[model samples]
Target: MYGDWSDAPRSLATLGYEPPIPGLIGSSQAMMEVYNLTRRVAGSNASVLLLGETGVGKEMIASAVHRLSQRAAGPFVKVNCGALSESLLESELFGHMRGAFTGAVSNRTGRFEAAHGGSIFLDEINSTSLHLQVKLLRVLQEREFERVGDTQTIRVDTRVVAASNRDLMDEVEAERFREDLYWRLNVVPIRIPPLRERREDIPELVAHFLNVYSETNERHVVHIQREAMEALQDHDWPGNVRELQNYVERAVVLAESDELTVDLLPPEIRSGTKRPPLGMSAQAFDLDTLTQEVVQQGLNEADPDAEDLHSRVVNRVEKELIAQVMQACSGVQTKAATRLGINRNTLHKKLKEYDLDS
Candidate 1:
């Protein structure tokens, strides 16, 4: 955990490395790889498919690609495909004629037309129905599409960058997404790593968010307490950077002093409690059997004359619980912590004490 502002680098530039994308902050190797890929593909006209879990900054990457591309000076239009119905999305993408269906008040230009000579970021493209996918495929291949009610074709010099939180190939296989459209949008696929995969970047992210929220909320919470930083770093962050950003904003708004203390953090973060561990149906996950093993180990290792015998048994029970959750999560610490309903920092400490870190 970062002990002070002096110990944390706010951005890649602060560490003497120029940021590949101006606004991106992380300097971790995982993000470095993503930066490299983004830089390489930004100049090309090929469609980019950003693959990642939700809140992993796919829109940022998409924006970076457009800004770094030849279409920087042109209009940059964005549309969320999953947010609209098939008919509505069709009219949204390709302009609809007046009275196209019923709500077409006037001849309004669509996203592709508005994005002429620029780029269009289609987010949540996987949510598009198969019917809409066919039209999208046409626009990608022909660079032309007709409005919802108009028959005349409209051509545009626009680039497409699509994003999805789900595995598009899985959708393709399941017949939820068109295979042809999948190949079209997947000309360059970039998989954004989740926050848990890049723990080293947490301090920088926390620092950045602290500065942002402090200024926005008129708070002076500049310094982060050591314990608070540790809790932030140890979190599983299943919701990724967006989640971290929200938490930091909350802390800044609630801070009593200039420092962000552990008490300012949410209860689940400080206590490491999420929910009870899920007991998968497997022989090795038999709680009774595991409890017996843990109790036996406790009996052999504990002091014979110790007055805290009950505490020792309780400790053994906790160890067994942690071990079982770890097994159920395939030894993934973040997932195990979440399943065990404990803070990851607490889980890590318990694992080390019980010699279950492996």
Candidate 2:
């Protein structure tokens, strides 16, 4: 899993290589606070703990710290703690000498060693087991470790930067994490606000991702159409910058023209206000997702032995939909029926059948 993470090159912006996107933050007050904290802590070698929801750019912040620090000229290594199994992870982080384990074919360098003289980012660090956390704590305390199969202590200068979406202190309180290690890593804490909290930066982020992905994919897509940008800005961006980058890239690749339009955007973004309106083009009623979601929710909540399960589920969906359309059409039965692509008579019959008629 670690094989897939892209390292933020030291000179991302000034260099021609695609600037690594770590969800750039704009000037929102919450963002400014993060920006200020990052700047203040970047110059120090103290262990840093980045707190935020997933895809909120903790990695980017980590990269920013590495770049702004004295270690900018050295290698920057990254590891996703949640992505590896304990044995494999221990071996991966602390090099496993040949014959250390069955698959230990040869001696290899661990990420910390590779990051010597620079920084090593431990992403999703809260996933580590207490056993490993203790080892990590030891490293932070002594900056010394041995290979998996060897007892000889090897020392290296590596800056430890860690991130987690879950509250580590809560983990500590729950005994899922070691409090000592938490304090060690929490030397400097920085919280990155989710995309929704920094809505003002949406437009600029869209433009930045658009340019980067366009060049990366050699796509001619130039700009986001106004309506598309509006849609983007309206989204809560539950996935944060990573989601935004991926969404933009998808639109860019699919867009036939130079501009990204609402038509090219995902249903979530196209209908920013909520789910796409009931009736749309043959390609866009957007029923599949809505149906699945509602159906899954019903199944999950309903008793398995509930009588007439099929009829009950269908009736619930029909009732909810009719009520929704009726409300959308301001209780105008005819307009609601028209939008629903059904005859007014059938709409009324179903509405009455489901007790949704006024």
Candidate 1 residue runs with Cα over 4 Å from true position = 1-18, 274-358
Question: How many backbone clashes does every candidate have?
Answer: 7, 0
Q: Scored by Cα lDDT, where does model 2 land?
A: 0.82
Per-residue CA lDDT of model 2 for 279-346, tens digit only, reads 22222335777688778877887898888879877877777677777765556666677788999899
What is the C-alpha local distance difference test score of candidate 1? 0.86
lDDT score, candidate 2, position 200: 90
- For every model shown, what is its TM-score relative to the native structure? 0.73, 0.68
Best candidate according to TM-score: 1
Model 2 misplacement above 4 A:
1-25, 273-358
Residue pairs with clashing backbones, model 2:
none
